[model samples]
Target: MPKVSVKVKWGKEMYPDVEVNTDDEPVVFKAQIFALTGVQPERQKVVCKGVTLRDDSWANFKLSNNALVLVMGSKEEDVPAAPVEQTRFVEDMNESELATALDLPEGLINLGNTCYMNATVQCLKTVPELKNALLGYDPSSGGGTAGGLTSALSETMRALESGGAGACAAAAARLLNALHAAAPRLAERGAGGQLAQQDASECWTEIVRALRMRLTVAPEPNSKSLIEQYFGGTLDVELVCSEADEPPTRSNETFLQLSCFISQDVKYLQSGLRSKMAEQITKMSETLGRDAVYTKTSKISRLPAYLTVQFVRFYYKEKESINAKILKDVKFPLELDVYELCSPELQERLTPMRNKFKELEDASVEKSLNAKNKSHGDSKKENKKRSIVPYWFENDVGSNNSGYYRLQAVLTHRGRSSSSGHYVAWVARGDAWLRCDDDTVSPVTEEEVLKLSGGGDWHCAYLLLYGPKILEVPEEEEEPMVTDVTEGPAGNPPTALA
Candidate 1:
C-alpha cells in the first residue's frame, strides 16, 4: 500500500488538501479529515472515485496520488436531552479525562481577584522554550546565568516540581508560590471577602524576576538570564524640543514589557505602542530659561526572541479612587513587523534575514502554485515536515533579526477596572486557538482571537506575546550548475571533438 496525497472537497467548498497513507485503517484517515473539516470521525462519509471508502479496508479502494475525495458529514453530533434527575458540576467531572481528551493545558483556580495573575501565567506558559528551560533548570541549585534572582523562593519553587493537575495549574502554582515568597500578603484576600487586586503588570514583572534568577541559559553559563533571553530589550530614548537653544538629551533604558497607551484616536494595538513611545509635553525647563516644547522618541537597541506588549488601558480615577479601564477598539495583527521600531544599525543588521523571509514567502507561493498545477507525487512528500527546525542567526543570543513575530498568546481583561475585571488567556497551540478563562478551557478560532480587541469590551487584549516567525526552508541543496565545456566563450560555442 502507498500513501497518496488527495484534494478533499465538501459541497462547493474545498478543504485543506491532505496526504493519507493507504496502509492505515480508514478510521485513521477519517480523523485527519475531522481535524480539517470539523466533521466527527464517526459520522464522516468519504467517497473517492465513485467508491465509498470503508473503515476497515483502505487498500481495496486502490487510491493513488492526486486522488479527489468528497467528505460528507456534520460539524457535530446531536446530543440527547439532558437527564433532569441529577445535576453535575465541573468538579464532579473527571479532570484527567476532560483535560486529556481535549489536550488542554492545565488551568489555574482563580483565587478571588487573582484572574490577573492567572491570565499572566497562562500567557507566559505558551512559550515552549521557557517551559523547556523551567523543566530542566534545578531551582534548588542556586545557579543562574541571570544574576538578579534571589534564592529565598527556592524551596517554594521546588515544591511546585512534585506534581500538578494541569498545565495551567503547574505554571500558575509555581508562579504564585514565587510571588507569595516576594510579598506574603499578595496571596491573601483582605477583609472585604474579595481578594485585593494587584496590578497584572506587577505580577508579570515579579514572575519573570523569579524565573530569570532560577532558570539558567544552559549554553552560556553566565551570559544573561532566561528572562533577558526571551523578553529583555534595550531602547535608546531621545528628548528634543522646538527651541533652537535647547540641547536635546538622550538616554538608554531596559524594558521587559512594552506598553501601548489607549487614547480617543487609538483604534489599533500597533498605533497605541507608537503613541506610548512619542511623548508630547508642555513644560518649563530650568536650564532653557523658558517654557520649552519637548517630545520624546524611543527606538529598539536590542530585540528579544519573545516580545511582550502591554496595552495601557487603565488609569486611576480620582472620583472613585479606583483604576478605570478604557473601552476602545484596537485591532491587533496576528503577525507583526517591528522594523520601524529598530535603530538604524539594528535595522541594517536585519536586512539579510528580512530578505530571507521575503524569499521564503515567494517560494511558498510558488510551491502552492506548483502543487495546484503540477499534480506531482513529490509535492506531498515535500510537505511532510512543516516546522522549520534548527533555525539560527549569526550571533543569535538575543536577536530577532527578521523583525517578524507571530502572536502566540494574548492576555485579555473584561469589565471596567483592573481589580474587579475578569481575565482570560488566548493561546495558540499548533494551528488551534485555546481560550483559557480560569479553569474553563475551550477551543477557539483565529477570528475569535481577533475579536478580543476592545470595542464594547467583552474581553480586550491587555498584553500580547509575540514569538519569532521562522521560515521553513528546503533541507536539500540545489544541484550544482553543470559546466558547459562545449561553450568556450560567450560569443560562440567551441566545436565538440567526435
Candidate 2:
C-alpha cells in the first residue's frame, strides 16, 4: 500500500495535505491525527466511504487520492465545546503556546559555541532512568567538580522536562557555567576572544562520568549507581601470545559506552565494533619475558539497558593542527541484534528471552492478520489465550533481558572537524522523532534520522544511543468504531458510498 494525501474534516475545520500510510496499523494514522487535532486515538472516529476506521485493519475501505476523512470526536476536556469558529489552528498559536499544545520537549539555548553540550544533553535525556536518577540526585552529599556538574545537569534537565522555553535557557546557562568551571579547556577562547566549539563526544563522556560519580540510585542491591547499572556493560577479554606457549590471559572489563573505530574496511557500525573486539598489540609475555605480538579478543559479557556507541570519526592531524573527521557513511540498524557479539555464557543467558521475543513478534503478526478476517467476538476470544513473557532477571528494570536494542537517540555533527562543526540531537518520541538543534526543536521522521549516517557535508551520526528492545502483546479489544460518511461532501459524491 502507498501513502496518500487525504483531507481531514473535523467539525467545520478542513485540514488539507494530511498523509496516511496504508501499510501501517490505523492506530499509527490516529497518532498523526492526534498530533494535529489534539484528539486522543481512542476518542477519534475516522469515517470514509461509510466505513469507520479500525485499529487492526483497513481492508474494509479502498481510500484513493484526495479521499476525505471525517474525524468526529472532541477532546475529552472539550466534550462540551462551543462553536468550531472559536477554535484556533496550530498555526495561529503563539510560540510558547504552540510548544505547550504540541507537547514538545523544551530545547536548550546555545550559549555561544555550546551546541555540542546542548546536543549531548538532549541525547542523554532520552534515557528515563538517567533522568530520574538526576532528578533524585543530592548535590549536597556529593563532593568535588562532579557534584556541581551533577547539580547543574539536574537543574537543566528539570527545566527541559518542565516544557517551558524561558526555564530551558536559564538552566542551560547554568549548566554551561558549571561546565566552564569544571573544565576550563572546554571553555577555551580563540585568538579573537570568542568561545571555541568543543567536542560533543568529549562533553558526553564528561557528563556520564559526573553522573556515574554522583546520582546514587542503585538499580540493584550491590550496584554502584543508576548510571553504572543502566549504562554499564562488561567485556570478557582474552589475550593470546603468538610466540610463547603460555595460557591465554582472561579478564573482565566494564564500559559505559562502546567505541566504534572506523577504518577503510569498516562500512557499518557492527563491523566497526567487531574490528575493535580483536586486534594485534605488542606486550611483554610472562613466558618469554620479552616483547611479543598478542592477539587481543574481547566479547560482551553483559548487556546494558541503555547502550551508547561513539563513532571514532575524529583523528588528530598534526599538519592541520586539528581533529580531522572521517566522512564515511557507516550504516546502522534501527533494531540491533547483538547475540553473536556476546560471550558464550552471556548468550546462553540471553537465549530464553530472545526466543520469547521472537515468539511474541510472530504471534503479533498472526493476530493482526487474523483480525482482518475474524469477527469482533472472535477477536475478543483470542485475547484470553494470550501468554506473558516473564522478565529474564530478578531486577530487570535497568538491564537488558535479551541481546537486542532499538535506536533511541542519535547525536550528529555537520562539519569536517569535531572542534568546528554544528551538532544536533535526534531523539525518538514514540513513533516520531524530535530534532533538537540549539533551541529549535522540530518533528522529524525515522527516514530522516537514518539519513544522518555520514557521507558528505551533511549531519553525520557521531554518537548513537540504543535502548533495550521491549515488546508488548497487544489486547484484542479495540475502541468502538463509528460510521458516518453521509455528513461530509466528499463522501456523499455522485455515486453511493460503499
Give the worst 10-residue stretch by lDDT in candidate 2: 489-498
Give lDDT per model, in order: 0.67, 0.77
The weakest ten consecutive residues by lDDT in model 1 span 489-498
Clashes of 2: 0
User: After best superposition, candidate 1 residue 23: deviation in angstroms?
Assistant: 58
Best model number under lDDT: 2
Clashing pairs in 1: 106-166, 106-167, 106-168
Candidate 2 lDDT, 254-282, residue by residue in tens = 99999899988999899989898999999
Error of 2 at 148 (Å): 0.6
Prediction 1 global C-alpha lDDT: 0.67
lDDT of 1 by residue, 1-498 (tens): 467788889777786547876644465566566556656544678998888876546645767777789988776435556664455455654544345335665555553466787677668767655654554454456433221133322322232335343323333434444466575656555464334777677777777776765565544455466677667888998888866456788999998878888888888777887887788877787777888888888999788878999888889999999899888888999999988888898899888778877887897798787775765677566766343422224455544667888999999888898877688889887667888776567666688899999888598888899987765555452112211211211222111110
Off by over 4 Å in 1: 1-101, 142-177, 184-188, 218-222, 282-286, 289-291, 375-381, 384-392, 477-498
